[model samples]
Structures are given as C-alpha cells and as structure tokens.
Target: MIFRHTRLIMGTALLAVALPAVPAMAQDADEARIKKLEAEVRALQRKVFPGGDGRYFEPQIDSSAPVTTTSSSPASTTAVTDILARLDALEASLQRLTGQVEVNSNAVRDLESRLAALESGAAPAVAADNLLPDEQPLPAAAGPAPTPPPAPAASGPSAQRLAAVQAIAKPQTDDPGDDEYSYGFRLWNAGFYPEAQQQLAMFVEKYPRHPRATYGRNLLGRAYLDDGKPREAAPWFLKNYQEDRNAERAPDSLLYLAESMIALGDTNRACIALAEFGETYPAIAAGRLSNQYEANRKKVTCN
Candidate 1:
C-alpha cells in the first residue's frame, strides 16, 4: 500500500517533469507513455478503493499528450499538482490509522500483561505501558504524588561537566550561531541528550536563518532519539524534511524520521519515509546515508 502511494506520486511527478522536456518523438510513443500512466492510475484507484464504484474517481490525464508543453501551462499543471496533493493526504490518513492501530495494540498488550500477572499472582501491571518505547513519562512535576522522586540532582564533577558543556565552543566561522550549534553537537556527541536538546532547540529558535539552523534542527531530533524519546524526535525530523527538502541536512532528517518512526512502533510510516528518501534523494541514499537507510529499512523489512 505504501509503495502504491509512492509509485502513484512519483509516476505523476515524472509526467509533470517529462512533459516539459520530451524530445520530438513519434506520436505513438507519447500516446503509449500516457496510456501506461493512465493504467497505473486506474490500478492504484482499484487498490485504494477496493470493491467501490470505479466511476467515482478517475485519473485526469488528457489523451492528446501535448508533447510540446512548457512550464507556462499553469492551468493544466494544477490538476496534476492537485492529484499529487490528494495522494499525500491519503498517505497521511493511512499513517494516522496506523498510529491508532499502534495505540490499540499497546492497550491489548497491557491487558495481556495484567492478566498474566494475575494468573501468576504477581504485582499488578499498572506500569506495563511505561515499558512501551513510545510511552512518554509524565513531567516530574506533573507525575502522581506516589511517583518516584526525580533522580538526585547531578553533583560534583557531574555538575561541572554539565555547566562546562553548556558554554558555546570557540567560533570556527564568522557566524556565532555556528558556534552555538557546535555546542549542541558536542553535547550530543558526548551523550548529553537532554542538554543537547535544550541547546539545539535554543539555537534553532534563536537563529532560524543561520546556515547551521538545519543542522541544529536535525541534531535536536537526534538528541531526543538518543534520549529514548522517539515521539519527541520524529516531529523535528519531519519538520526539517518538509520545510526544506533540499537543505544539506534534509536527507538526514528524512532518514532519521524513518528511524524514529520505526522506534515508535509505526513501521508503516517508517516504510513510507524510507521509500520517500529512496525516491526523492536516490543519490544521497546510495552515498552517505546508504548504510543507515539500509539498516533502518531492514528494521521495518519494507516491502
């Protein structure tokens, strides 16, 4: 199903792209290509709305196959763009449905654990859901009175370590924002997830126009993920990917988005992200991001 959405979008995008640059070709070849696209669209509709009336929806590709199209035909291109937008909406709906499924699955698991505990005469499963990766702990102040006290504050060298790393690194470039971002990077690299998140978040918010802002945003997501909080991480990665698909760190954001989704038990969405990364950034996927993407794809076992 995910692949179907990807193929439909990419295929239609290809049409919008190929239409403008099509070489002078035999009329029949253009017709054949349009025919293939039309067929794929129909197949997609049937798969998407199985056992439903086919007449309710149809691909809007004109059969004439204007071979000399330029970028000027905004009216004609709008329909194709709209089709792609609707496909994206459908994909979003599917992801929401998957999230609901995950919630339901977790509920069932909690119930099963409770029943097992009863059978064995063990402690109640009150905190079974806490064991779930996607379950976020309440804020310390918001937690129940019975909740365990927050961990003792860092002390001695630990306090020194935290305060010491909070200072920004020396400026490597003219941009002080770059140094601020490096501070977050150093924190993350040193395994200070919470501090890294705070630092990166401030850096991103304060210097939204900085060259390293994209890097800052992506690193913020990494901090959350490293802190075992994928729910916190996924949105930042997604925002970076959606906001600036061509940014230097955008590919990393997309890949990390997949990893976070997988961690959160939403392999359906993770698979979609993985497929998008492969489709939209094939070169990067085959180059620097290849290993991580491959490992993540294996985690989801994407079809």
Candidate 2:
C-alpha cells in the first residue's frame, strides 16, 4: 500500500469500489472527492515533471550544477530559497498522497478478501469472525432497558488485579487466539467489565486479523453497553459495521448499534440502524440473529 516513488502505479481497481451500497447522491459526492484528489495528483505530477515527461523519480533538488542566486530582489524572492520552499511543499503533498493511497488500497484489498471468504457462504462480504464457531445469542427478552451513559468509576483497577491478569501464565496454546479471547470473555463473564474491556481492547489490537478479533471489537461495544454507557457504545458498533460488514460480528455490531441508539433515546436512528441490518444481512436476519433482530425491530417500531 505504501506508494514508493519507484512503484507509483495507481490501479483502476482502487477507483472501482465506491463505498458499497452508497446512495446516488453520496456516490456522486465520493466521485467528486476522488476527482479532486486526482486533480491534486496531476498537479503534483506536473511539478515533478515540468516537461510532462516521466524522467525524474523525485523533484530535482540540485541537478548536477550547484545553484547560486545573484539577484537584486528581496531575500524571500531569491530563486534558491523559493525553490527550496516549493520542494518542501512538494514533499509534504507527496506524503499526503502516499497516505491516502495506502488507506484506500488497504480497504480495497480487505473488501476483496472478504468477497473470497464469503463466496461459498450465502452472505456476500463478511468478517473473519464468521469463521469461528457461533456463540450463543442473547435471548430477545434479555435485552437491557434503555440506560444513560455512566460517569467513570472512582479509580483504575487495583494493582493486585492487574498482576493476576498479567500473571496468567498459560503456555501458548495451539489456539492462542481462542486463549486470548477466552481470558477477556472470562473477565467480562465474571463482571470485571473494566478489566474485560481493557483485555478485549488489547486482544483486538494485538491480533487484529485473528478470527476472534472482530468479536472482540463487538464485545468492546457490549462492555460499554452493559456498563450503562450507551453513548460510548454506539460508536464502536456503528464503526465495526461501517468498516467491514463481512466481519462475523458485524451483524451483531449493527444489532448492538441499534440497541445503543435506542438506549440513547434516538429511536429514529435506531430504526435506521435496524433497517440497515435487515438490508445488509437478510439471510442472517432470517436465521441465527432472527430473534434478536426481530426484537430490535419491534423495540424501534420500524415497519
């Protein structure tokens, strides 16, 4: 994804995947952004190749001969200082473009991988969480009543508690991924919500591509939800879905997002999230998540 000057080819595939399922107006807006970015790129190219020929790999600092300025103009207007400033500007622009390309490229590759993973399955694109064995879903009636966001607890975890978690000296199990997740799950299940949140956050960060990572992210949101911080919880679920709907926990994240929305008294947005979940995971809505999905729909009063 890093666009080294030596390999600066922009592929059409990067341009091909507009944000999936975007409305026509949003699609147009995305295109406009791309066009603006393209225009900026072309402007940079022209500066790098003044002759419009791709002869130079980088902006020429001092080609062969040294440059000396002998001008009556102000010091700020001296050719060398101005040229140096322009070069600095060019380097900054290149860095910006490089970062943008890297992000877009990674997203495209992620989408492609998800497509391949879900090819045999009924759903379209989904997350690595899908590869793991399904966890028992919460009963519809078990959904929590709406609650306000909570203030932080008085203090951080006790030193002894941190030491115990750190002292968990299990050997690297064959399924370390499961081992990692189970530790956090155990913490959460035991009502160590803050500690569980911390450990789950760590698990997701350290093993982002692991099958359990996606679930860890959803669980992070759930931890917030269960802790009576729906304001804090909504974002995690919404973002997990927005980023990669193929994620095994993405449907769960969406469901939780709606739940968070309801808790926050945003029933209109809650209905919208429910609608999106139904639209994005129709088969899931009819199957594994059917009960929870239906419960959310009825709660939101969506048609």
Candidate 3:
C-alpha cells in the first residue's frame, strides 16, 4: 500500500511539471508566428510603398479573438513611438525646404526690384544748355576814356600843391597795362576778396586778348570756390577751358569743373569731363588724376 502511495505522489508531481511546460511551448509557438507575420507585413509594406520609410504592423487574429493585454501593449507602444519619430522627421524636412524656398523668393524679389529701378530712368539730368544764356556778360571798359588835363602849376609846396603833383606824377592805372595783370595778386595779398573777384572778372572780360586772361579766369573760378560756392565757380572754369584748351591752367580748370559737377550731382557731365581730362592732357592726367578718372568712369551708367 505504501509503494502504491509513493507511485501516485510521483505521478502527480510529474503531471504538474508537464502541464506548465505545455503552456510554455504554446507561448513560444505563438511568439514565432508573431515574428513571421511581422516579417511578411514588412515585405508587403516595402512592395506597396516602395522606397517609403513609413511602416505598419497588424496581428493575424479574428475580430472576435481575445488579445492578451501584455503582448499587445509593448507592440502598440513601439509602433506609436516609430510613427511619432517619423512624423517629427518629416516636419523637420518640410521646415528646411520652406526656409530654402523663402530665401530663393527673397533673392528673386530683390533682383526684380533692381531691374525695375534700372528701367525707370532714375538718372542724372541733361539740361537744355549747360550755361544760362541770360546770365550777365563779363564787364568791359569802352576803349581808353578821355583823360583830364593836368591843372596849372601851384605857386608853392603847400598840401594842395603837393597832392596835385603827386596825382599828376602817378602813372595812369585805369588802363589794363602790365600793372593790371598783378591786380588779382595784390588784392588777394591785401585780403580784399571782393576787389579780387572784380579785378579777376574784369581781367577775363577786358584783357581776354591777353595771354594771361585764361589764367585769370581759372583764378576767378578758384576764388568762387574758396568762397564756398561751387555752382558759381563752374561757369568760370568752363569758360577758361573753352577760351584756351592749351592754357597752363586749362587742365586745372577742367579738374575743378569735374569736381563742381560732382557736387551738383551731374554725374554725366562729370564722366565727360573725366574722359576729356584723360584724353587731352595725358602726362599730367596720368600722374595726378588716374584715380579720379577711374572713379568717375565707374560712376557713369548708361541706359
């Protein structure tokens, strides 16, 4: 009877162990089936959506079948994480593309605006005539005016007699004689700017026949410039250049003329002046004005 009891106990223990192993084997088989289904789903996704990174996974179970909570939860969480990551990556790519497009759009707009501005003819003015026709001509004296005769000799060397002798002995200065050429220099030295201007203008008008008149005109323009009036100086500079292109002061006057035109925003005229300067006086221009000529040449824009 004891042997029969021992056999029954051993059999019960063996059955308990065997029953636990049965569920384990079934679980392992189910896991392998799940792996196979996953591989098939991956292949189908690759075939349906070629070259696409998006993926989908589904278990092969009847609609009415009960799903184990623990098995489904991990897979569902993994799929959700993968989808969220893919969505974030897609959004990042879209943002980068959008930024690039915006940059290109702004560059195109800037170029279009530049083209429009160029087409609109917003350039320097070309006046009807550079010089005003109605402006005052330089002053000129009618040929030598009649001179008054010397008064009768005074009796003695009184103040009036001395003054009369002194006046008579003083050489005639009204004439544009050799002394007149130095009039501008004297006035400048004496700090008489107004008188210097008048004398220089008179020299330009009356002594235009003189060889030094061209120099005087240049000085007159410089005088106006020293007085802080480039507009007023430009005409005299132009006249000096017109009167004597080969004068010693001609190139200087032309240079000043270009400067005046630049001040007046007359870039076209400045360009012309620069070109003329380069062509007319090559030696002096090459030495002194190369940079200015190049700058003005660059500033010129033609339609």
Candidate 4:
C-alpha cells in the first residue's frame, strides 16, 4: 500500500510539470505566428500607403504573460471592442481629409488658370448659355477694303489731321475691352489707315499694360509710314523698339524704322538701323516680313 501511494504522488507531480510545459510551448508558437503575421501586414501597408512613412496602428498584446485557453474576462472584451470602435472612427476621419485635399487641389488649379489669363490680357472663357443674344459677334467681312492713296507730306500735323486720326469710334462687345484691340487690328488690315490709327491710339490709352500693347504701338507706326508721314512714323517705331526689344513686333518696327529713315533722307541712320536689325534677330526668316528687309537693304545699298 505504501509503494502504491508513492507511485501515485510521483505521477501527480510529473503531470503538473508536463501541463505547464505544454502551455509554454503553445505560447511560444503563438508568439512566432503573430510576429510572422505582423511582418506580412507591414509589407502590405507599405504598398497600400507608400506616403505614410510606415506609420500604422497595431494592437498591443502582453508577451510577458503566457496565453491560455481560458475565456477572456468581461473588462478585457469591452476594452478590445472600444479599441476597434476608435480605429473605425480614425479611418473615417482620414477619408474625409483625403477628400478635402482633392477639392483644394482643384481649386488651386482653377485659380492659377484665371491668374494666367488675366496676366496675358485674355478674357476668361464664358459658357455659351451665359452670353446674351446681342453679345453674339457679327461675321467678319469676306474681303478687306481697297487701300487709299498715300496722303501728301505736311510740314507738321494739322488740327484737321489730328481730328481725323482720332475719329474712329470703338465698338462694343461682351468682352469689349479685349475685342477693341482685335477690331483695330482688323480695321488696319482692311486698309482703313486713319481709322486704324485712331482705334490703336485709343487701345493704347485704355490698356497701357496689356500684353498686345507692343503690337498696337508697332502697327500705329506702320499706319504713319503707309500714310506718307515718315517723320511721324520714326518716333513711334523708335518707341516700340526701345520699350520692348524682345517683342514679336520689335524686329518689324526696326525694319520699318530703317525704311522711314531712308525716306526722310537719313541714309546713314537707315544703314545703322538695318545693321542693328540683322544683329538682334539673326534667325528671323525673310518670310515673316514679306521680304521687306531684303527690299529695304537693296534700297539703302547696305554692305
């Protein structure tokens, strides 16, 4: 009976040790699996949110204590539920912020387009429905009018001449300010030199800082030259060239100025002007000026 009692006690002690060891082995296995799952989750997060700089939420588990098969206490379950609820709220807040960022980005692009148009002296594009019936533009004339003969040279600008130069009325449009310049350019091309000069003068007065201001000034000089007033044209050409040498019309103004100087019996200055034109716009094609540069060069006999 004593031997049987001793055997039973030894068996009980061995069972106690074996039970604790099994739990410890299970805890170690669970920890290894959790670590492997965490690594995979981190890799997925890196791909899903490359801009997040590895930031993410991970639930904390106590590694110091061994896990068991026992059911969780009520307090622990409640805490886990609260944590899940907070994570859901955080996800919703992030979505709202992302939406707001997209909206702001669109607003910024719209503002930039408007600012660029304003700087370029171009009116913003209006929807067709927003325009009034009267705001509709009339069809441009099929052909330009015949050019009149050049006026006679005068010792000075007369009162009648000045009045004629300022007589053309500006037309009204939905974007009247912008269209006024176009109207002047069309009138000039249509051979209405006096009216063109007047309209261009008005444009310069109104939109002094406009992007097309250089074009208006250059065309005004051409009007004076075509009207047989070389003396009057020279100053306008000089002004256009001096104001903005890089303007698209600047080289043309210089070329015309050289022609005007020749007409005014200043061949030395004309030759100098032609030299400057060649130096400033070396790559400019002859087609751009309708071969006027070559013709002028022949007239002055430049070397």
TM-score of each: 0.48, 0.46, 0.39, 0.43
- Report the lDDT tens digits of candidate 4 across residue range 191-295: 677767777778766876788888887888788788776655666676677668898788888888788878867666677677777766877734677488888
Q: Model 3 RMSD to the real structure?
A: 25.2
Reference-based TM-score, model 1? 0.48
| CA deviation > 4 Å runs, candidate 4 | 1-175, 285-287
How many clashing pairs in candidate 1?
A: 0
List pairs with backbone clashes in candidate 4.
Answer: none
Which stretches of candidate 3 lie above 4 Å from their native place? 1-178, 189-192, 288-303
**Ranking 1 against 4 by lDDT, winner:** 1
**Residue-wise C-alpha lDDT for candidate 1, range 1-303, written one tens digit per residue:** 768777876877677556655566644566566666666566555545554344735534433454332343484589779999999999999999999999999978865553332223111122664566744433221121111123345642376775766564645777789888988888888887777787788788789788898898888888888888776676677667656889999999888978887886766667667887887899999999899988998887766
Best by TM-score: 1
Off by over 4 Å in 2: 1-177
Pick the winner on TM-score between candidates 2 and 4: 2
* Tens-place lDDT digits, model 2, residues 1-303: 236422433642366374546898877876766665554454455454556354544443333444343323474368669899999999999999999999999978865553333222211223567644742222221123212233358865679877866665433679887787888887777676776777777777678788887788788888878988665566566556655789899999988888887876666667667777787799999999999988877776755
Better of 3 and 4 by lDDT: 4
Q: Report, for every candidate in turn, its global Cα lDDT versus the true structure.
A: 0.69, 0.66, 0.60, 0.64
Order the candidates by lDDT, highest first: 1, 2, 4, 3
Question: Candidate 1, overall lDDT?
Answer: 0.69
